[model samples]
Target: MATIAPSPPAALIDGFGRRISYLRLSVTDRCDLRCRYCMGEAMTFLPRSAVLTLEEMAAIADAFVARGVRRIRLTGGEPLVRRGIGELAARIGRHLATGALDELTLTTNATRLAEHAPALAAAGVRRINVSLDSLDPERFRAITRTGDLGQVLAGIAAARAVGMAVKINMVALKGVNEDEVGAMLRWCVAEGHDLTFIETMPLGVVDEDRTDRYLPLDGVRRDLIERFGLVADAHRTGGPARYLRVPGTATRVGFITPLTENFCDGCNRVRLTASGRLYMCLGHDDRVDLRAAWREGGRDALDAAIDEALALKPRAHGFRIEERDAAPAVARHMSATGG
Candidate 1:
């Protein structure tokens, strides 16, 4: 095993008192589907030139890695929608190969993953997280305007075949696909996929009524346990999810209850929009633009923008209804900011 080196101290705080270590970068703001909750009527496309050039992104990433940001996850409306994404993956992987980056991964919708999974794996991406809300064809189409369940399934299989550590992500919306939760879990368990059931957040183009379907994760888990006899706290060691194992199976079910069980205090993430703005939190509005600084202000200016964003990181989201009311515009849409 490679010996892990100690992380050096870094002094940067966003307005919220959280140290920024993980940077989630968006390569494009465009997507193939208009997922009901994420992209509504249409998307306001960012200009081509506005998105960072590969070199520019690598520069910002380099600076962040230098300042203790060791985890990088490339995200987007759907990162694979962007042309030459695999090339970018290779570039980022090569940058990280220098021993600065501790983890590098991608979060994609997986519609185009089957075509790119092999390339991504060859580029050194050992981890992939695919957003797959439903296994039912009709329900999948209903959730994402034009996604093909067959294609998504193929993509997941392709990634696993390529030897990538795969994680299947699902967003649990109450009345819509809540009934199918058991089926999805059963499928994942049989397939040996690390499944995460995330609670629907009140961001993006979510319909107000969708909140009614926002099954608080606790009740969902309770029902599953009552039905399946879940053995609590049986999650794998060092696992991010708090999971429960089925009564007589090796498979485990995991939950990401952002609403009921907020993981904000341990949040080590920062987001970079497709247009190069750095967000300290999903609950923050204004962001520091590193791309603009790289163009006009140079390297020093770029570093300053990172420092500014990090110094403003919130200690905790303090996510409550009142907080949401106060920061009504704080929540950035999931697709554009990367869900």
Candidate 2:
């Protein structure tokens, strides 16, 4: 017999007064593409039994929504790879219809979005972020290892055709695709999609040293300023990206600088892994095993675990370049953490 803790309060406020309103939920750890920066060449995915069932995910999301979560983003090794994800999206849609959830979004590699986009849009998903590094087929194949540029492009088109607001996320690596910053920006703008340039952070394990691949967005921004005369915009999409707009053009660009710039002060989100672990911070290993707690003690136990985990959310992530080189590497990969 175990003691059942009290129900979690309706308000989820951390020690730093950052009200928790956003949730990034990983549906599955399986992926179709092996992006060099995201995962290693050889990867071991969690068994289906180890991952959360759609019902379990819905229950956990409900718990969070009951607390204070308004926005939920489904992530994964690639969320589209998860079977029957449309069902989960529809389940979350019920919450959205009732005003319990403000937004239901997803981040995917867009490999399978062509098939899943219609189903996802019908299920109430209106916003999507596609991870595309290069527009060139050969370069894209090299970066993703096995991704087809044509398929990804079709997927992006499908998502837009289905009326979902599409955003392109590009992880800029020094010698890999940094040279294509201008081209990527131009292509995204031409396609009427906002593009975000992300600074490669120290997450997961890769064959090459992370420092070798690290490319900050400062140089990219300088080039954009010089080339397009881009200026900072006051618009924020409720994420980490700093938005900028090109003068006389409707195109907007964003920079997510997790290493050079830290946005933890305004951090208002927590992540739930596919294995039912709640992570307080992305850069830290602090997590609560909610699956065990839920199986053993039900909702109260899950709430208790979440309460305990929220208390440990660090003020800031220690993911600086020097610390990345010096500190012990994180054991869990980004796929496992739902990056």
Clashes of each: 13, 0
lDDT of 2 by residue, 152-182 (tens): 9999999999999888999999999988999
Candidate 2 local Cα displacement, residue 238, angstroms: 1.9
Per-residue alpha-carbon lDDT of candidate 1 for residues 101-177, written as tens digits (9 for 90 to 100): 77778988899999999999887888788888888899899899898999988888899999987778888887888
How much is 158 displaced in model 2, in angstroms?
Answer: 0.6
The model with the greatest lDDT is 2
How well does candidate 2 score on lDDT at residue 141? 93
